[model samples]
Target: MSDHPFDVLAARALRVGAYLVRADDQGRLYDGIGLKPEHWRRAQTLLADAPEPWQKLLTSDPGDDRIILPNGGHILRLSSNRRGRHEHTILAVIEPCVCSKPLGQVLSESTEADSGCTNVTTPGQCNGCAAACLSDPITVECLLRCWYEDLFKLGRQESELTKLSQQLAETYEELNLLYRLGQELTVSGDPRCFVQSLCQDLLEVMSFRWVAVKLFDLPELSEQLAGMFVCEGTTQKTINEAEQAVEALAQMPQVHKPAVVLDIASQWGHLLPALGNSLLAYPLYKGETMYGLIVAIDKDPEAGDISSVDLKLVGSTASQLRIFLDNVTLYDQMHLMFLGTLEALTAAVDAKDRYTCGHSQRVALLSRQLAEALGLPPDRVERIHIAGLMHDVGKIGVPESVLCKAGKLTKEEYEIIKGHPEIGANIVKDIPHFDDIIPGVLYHHERYDGKGYPHGLAGEDIPMMGRLLALADSFDAMSSTRTYRAALPRERVLEEIQACAGSQFDPDLTPHFLSLDFSEYDGQVANHKAGDPGAQGVAA
Candidate 1:
């Protein structure tokens, strides 16, 4: 028999309560049964006891050989040629006696076979013996084995697919959480508020007893910590413990080093008893400047270990916070620079008319105060202040002769002065970050009743900032001495403003401007004159 035919017979023998063993040329035995520990021992003992028959099978003729053991178990050795070599042998062990019936009938009755056995032979025969008598035992065994293998393989595939689905779901949720954090961080302008918001949003996705952010005054190792922002889910005691732990770590020599995760108890020894042992401290840095540190304390036990995904999420969030901090710092520096530039530009315009040396500055101060009294937000008030200072910027293009003229001029000269608002607007329009101040600079001369210059933008049609600037500009011009006239009395200036509310000034803002006390500014006007050589004899 060939080795393939012998293998088929051996499998059938296994179905019929028999086990198969193959011995290689090296005398090593391979159990064809499931090879439990007991099965392997039995196979080894059986071969050891029947040494004569085993030796005869290997050295003598290639034929069937049988050995009857002391326990009445029979071992049949069948010789087979594998790959044209007759060196392989198959041993089948059957207890007591071999089944005379076919193996298929034995398996169908004894085991759950895929197909039913229809042979109606030998009444009163045992189920094993009856199934063994089936007509095509080899074909039946093959079909049953194939079905079992396929079902087992399918079960394993389904298990793997379920794991992949769960992994995909977790990844999607992490991405969504990070996206929400980005939105919250970007919208807030205050650093402390951003840190507090960061802690609150992080709680939604990650489990922690407390979270805190501590920022340094300077990005230097020796600088003192400036502020600390925190959010807590536990008691204040726990928050304090976490803070202490972070402070101790920051004071260490490795404070300027990379991020570290440490066991709170081991690292600080009862400093944070309320917190879990796992604490994550990530440094917030932009280049070499270490801005702050983000600390998450006492990870939830239910969340298991901190996974790689958790680390990646925290690291990315820290990067975003660092970016926002850098932007805010840069914006503040640029804001100071912008203010200085505006001051220099306005001084040049003031110099052209010595009588109005401090006129623009006073107008800016009053416009800012009036805007605040009107309940405008802080940012809007600031824009109005800048606009008031630059409202006369267009006069830079007018002849200094015309601007400093001592007496009323011809209609031609007045027209030349009226065009300054447009000229001023054009000059500042191209300067970067000046969009908010453009309208006021261009339309501060516009009248409330459609009678003023450049554009006859009337009433509410005028930009709100422009309307506010007009009131400030006109009041400063009348209250202070100009080349054409002496300074008007405070009451007289107030009467002029009150009478022109509807026609010259915004009706809604006129009363608000009139409500302000001019006496408080008297010292400020005197101080400006004291500093100006051109205002030596000007009446205040």
Candidate 2:
């Protein structure tokens, strides 16, 4: 019994006093209930003096086998653990002794002496003493009954162990689900993509019929993804019904208890999805911020109602999900704040020149439009938009007199003007996430034929942002009023842009810029004239 692995052999040890023992090494014992030193010494002696049939069981493969030994007035049971191993044997006894002499010893003494059996009405049948009942044939009806009772008790214990094993398995799978969700979180920061994947996985782990997760405050994602909808095993009507109920649920004081609407005739039955079972709706939130809600429909009937473990699993992940999205919201706010400050700085620069009051605003809008028209990704398009807004940020370094000059600039003034792109690039070069925007700010004035500006590399050597911004800047510059020239007509600007396709503009990217809608531009320009800031910054 050195290993003592009978923790789940819980019945016998709890009921009487089950002690672990090795069948072969009867002297050694383990996992024993309370027994004095004297009792332990007597226990070892009792096993050594056991009857032939009981002794044979010590070495035999009798799984769940039982043997009853007679003590003074009590009986002790030795039961096998059924594992066929020597160390897993169990000794169960309430109190092994009740009198000075054991029953087996008393019977042996009586069997040896005949004169004491004078009241024996029949052979081997004194009928008065307990020893007479086992006169010769030795039919112990009570011992047989004890054996059956032990067998039944052991069977019941096995059932309890099975239930415990199942609970452990459920816990293991829940941990696995958490691990996978953590992996998903590291790879994709998008909340919608995260929740969509979570719904699919939740169904598999919780054994639920369907799952619906919805976003509330994060509007950076699309409406289709943000709105509540069952991700699996449901229809649009059911999703719409859930969406309608969100306000009512949100208004009500929340209870952690699940609302089980299993009855088809229940009031919510018409709205809940999955005809098979129950519905569980849990709000995913942190303090006052309601990030989202997860609605689990029709939990498997066989799995029964939700347990604390189930709630904890969902709640733990929900808490993490909210944190991820909240961080993104904060990130977006910081980004917007930074962009706002940049707008203020450029508005001050434009303030130095009366004619170019809204020049940066129009260029920013058109550049963004052109990036989209050229099918650049969302992140790239955003960078280009910021680039356009700060395209002429270098003008802040130019003398106010030179910027507002009403005639063509002298050579020295033109040279001073040309240095603005380098000044603008240097201004923002060290700002985080502005690396790509630098080239656009520095090279917007560069031409396609390598004949333009500082470090004028030809063709595709120009950064993509620089290429796109060049086209947009030229378009806006030709159309907008400048200090030296009246705003050119729209058709003439188009003709001039086409004439300089390869020499001044990227021929491959030029067509995409030409096709963009200018209605927004027209409106912004009109707003500029009307003295409404619009996309334009504050007036000089």
Candidate 3:
């Protein structure tokens, strides 16, 4: 065959593969790869017609090197390496050009010659190519093998790149779905509805075959978080199968251990009967405590689809779900703490005055009843109850001489006593835990008519919880006994509660507080201090 342009050039360079490089005039060295004056000579010959300096000349090197031509004209040196250890020998081998499938198929189908076919030389001769022109008989053989390895390696790398791209795309889509689901859960204040949405999202977004969420039962929680399962196909048979598997898992005793189990069928043969071929179970934990387990089962027909790497991804996803559940639990705990502290603070205030040992508690109980009667928001009602409980907490700073003087306090003493609202507000201001409740305690004493102390924020300007607490506090104070006077009659207390509606109490809240049975407060007060209005009062 007549020599082609690439073949002629490659022959002159004494190299096996086609490649090119740019020569550098400035000599420099890094290990054996360096620039020398001889490099510029070869480059000058290749581009003889070029301008002076020859800084950008394409060079013909009898060495292994690669050239990159940007925009098809500007050539540059990409890489170069030594091919021989002890001699001035180099072969410019370019990155393998992708071979056509026809070429590969031919090579794969060719039979080995009787001469052992130890190298590509024998195979080339069998294919009727000139054997003498090809360099060292063994060289041709080694080159053929090397090219074959490189071709397959390139194909594998391309495949891995495509796979990673697809996985990244899928991850982005799942993250978007997670964000939307979080929004829906937040807006869905109904616990059951939130959980239902969570279950559906876990199935639709995560592609889990079976998903179940269970919550830890606690005394403070009025509603028990039952098992919620979502699956593509969850019939009685499937559920029974799942239940049996759960029971079997339960038998594997782990003392408060939260764990993730993979390929669970291998460990529990019983799981095989009902479960998919692959199972991944993650335990939901709050702190170090395991609340429950979320199990994802996959029985896809393709075995290769669920690899160890895949199971790890599923486990990580389950951890995010666990975090959401933990946050819900935390929210509940915070709500409870808010209510409890408010109650304790109110009780502490009542304890300071012997005559009102049970007064604060009775008012709180009445305030809760009134809040419900007035159809107030549950969260608002909760704040009101807390405010009522701690409404007199500032009294903790009040001296007993003033509280139990058994006589009307002078204006100076009254003014000092009235500062309790601001003082109580400041006491809890530093506690970030009760952010919402502090406002109620601070403003509960303000009157609707703008006559109340500490910034007389009037009417609707007063926080609804504060207004509600003001009405409840007044009702309890009017009905209870004091050191200087006997308890007022129930009719008189009701008349006062109604007369002061728009002025002293929230008009809407006053009627609700007036509707309560005053006898109930008297009973609670007597019961609370019956043992020792003296010693028990001392404890208060």
Candidate 4:
């Protein structure tokens, strides 16, 4: 007896009419259990000529197969392995046959009506028929059909599993790409920056010779390109030539097609000499409005052929890009409209008094500079600028008699003047998108020692933006000529600001503010009342 456990088990099973056989690639049997020489020879011959139904079991890694012997006296269940230590082995169990005749003979002799043998007779009454026999051909045929159906169902299930796995893998890859794209693209508020980041992200996920985004003039598709953003793996000349070619192709009367992948050479053969041929063009649209076009030129050799999956990915990305671009456009329009309204308000404030004409604009310009000098962020600086322009908006509510009184005011008049900051804050407090600017508008007049303002916010207790604005507002007020006094000399103004740094201005911020060059603004302000369209100035 072999000491190997598998051999011992196989020997014991074979004695009970089951067997184990191992064969090599050459069809030569290598091991056997519980079989006479004659039986062993017969099994080899049978397997060598196994029917097509057994092909899957023989070729697959490890699985089961059932077969009826040619003589039809035995049915066998075979477990096969195409891998591991028993790589060439097929272990089988012999099951007693249901029919004496071969399966084929039984099937050939049976009819569909024979399948309903049980239903043909009443409960106790005997309906004599050949199908009622102990080894009925119909029963044998039905059993064989069921086994065959089970095998087919198993095969179909495996096929479906393979397809499902492939689809899942593709979905995972697509989601990963989208996640990366969102991280890279959504950080910028500028449309051009957004498009540039998009191009870079696409190149990371896919292989392309060049990627380009073209935004069109909206509400009208007549202009083919309003703006173009491109990232190129090839020469700029090649990209430029290809862009021109694509533009020309768009003008063709035959090119009224939807977004799709196309053979670049076939569509624009004349331009093939200057540009490589494989490309995809996708139109960006929302509803009936066509926004733009996104194009990829030449698939990278490493990326293989562009497939339906690639097209699907690109289309999904384009849809998201469309929404982002639309939002950016809308924001820009709203921003311009807001600026126009603020400019009109500033103009009205200037109209209240001739000497104070353009005072708000100067303050706004200086405040932005001071905010920058203090190392505030761009967004905060922009808020300060707007606040400076609107700081005196409450002056509109003040009686012109007091505004242009041309002499020192009584205590009550001075008290009313101080209320402008509170009134300015109240005026804009309800306007949407002005939340950050309101603090600066309300506290620009607040003294560093807590002595000034409609509110007594002082020292560090004042908002940082309020402190910066206070310095800017005071500097501009002292520099500009007024009905009561001529403008202070620059040196004298600087001396006074330095003298009052801790008392009236943020001492920590005053040095940085004083360090900035106001020469460019001084020149502009000097020319302001002489009639320039608008004062153009910048801080150094």
- Against the true structure, whose lDDT is highest? 1
Each candidate structure's TM-score, on Cα atoms with residue i matched to residue i, is 0.62, 0.66, 0.53, 0.59
Question: In model 2, which regions exceed 4 Å deviation?
Answer: 1-175, 186-189, 217-260, 271-277, 286-291, 300-306, 530-540
Model 4 bad stretches (over 4 Å): 1-154, 168-304, 432-435, 449-451, 455-458, 488-500, 515-540
- Residue-level lDDT of model 2, residues 1-540, one tens digit each, is 111123322222222222223433452455343333444454555555555344445446534244545542122335555555334555543323212334465445333322222221222113344333332111232332354355557767877999899788877877788788777873224556777778888888887877777666456533333554446555334656656654344444432333434453364444433333455667765565554677666677788786666676677667666666656566666767977887788878877876676778888999999988878787778888999989898888999878878889999999999999999999888787788789999988888999888678689998878888888888877776676666788888888898899998899988887788989998887777677443332221
> What CA RMSD would candidate 2 show?
12.9
**For model 1, how does the per-residue alpha-carbon lDDT over 426-510 read when each residue is reduced to its tens digit?**
9989988888898889999999999998988898999998899999889888887787888887788889999999999989999
Q: lDDT tens string, model 3, 1-540?
A: 122322223222212212223222332211111212343333333333323322322233634122332211112232222332212222232222222223333333232211122222221123323211222323333443354345446657878999999788767756765676667655215565665665566556556566555444543233434344333435225665666565455446541343444555576655445655555555555665555565556634443444444445445555666655656656767767866766666766777776877666766777777788888787677666666676677788888888877778899888888888888888867777566767667887899998997898899999887887787777666666677666676678778778888998788776667676656556666677774456232111
How many steric overlaps are in each model, in order?
9, 0, 2, 0
User: Which residue pairs in candidate 3 have backbone atoms (N, alpha carbon, C) closer than 3 angstroms, thus clashing?
Assistant: 120-141, 346-389
TM-score of predicted structure 3? 0.53
Model 4, residue 159: what's the lDDT? 80
Candidate 3, which segments miss by more than 4 Å at Cα? Answer: 1-144, 159-201, 218-280, 285-290, 297-310, 318-348, 361-382, 407-419, 422-439, 449-458, 488-496, 511-527, 530-540
Q: Distance from true position, residue 345, model 1, in Å?
A: 3.1
Per-residue lDDT tens digits for candidate 4, residues 93-205, read 23222324444543333332232211112211123333221233234333543533454466678789999997888787778777766775542244566677777666666
Score residue 495 of candidate 1 by CA lDDT: 92
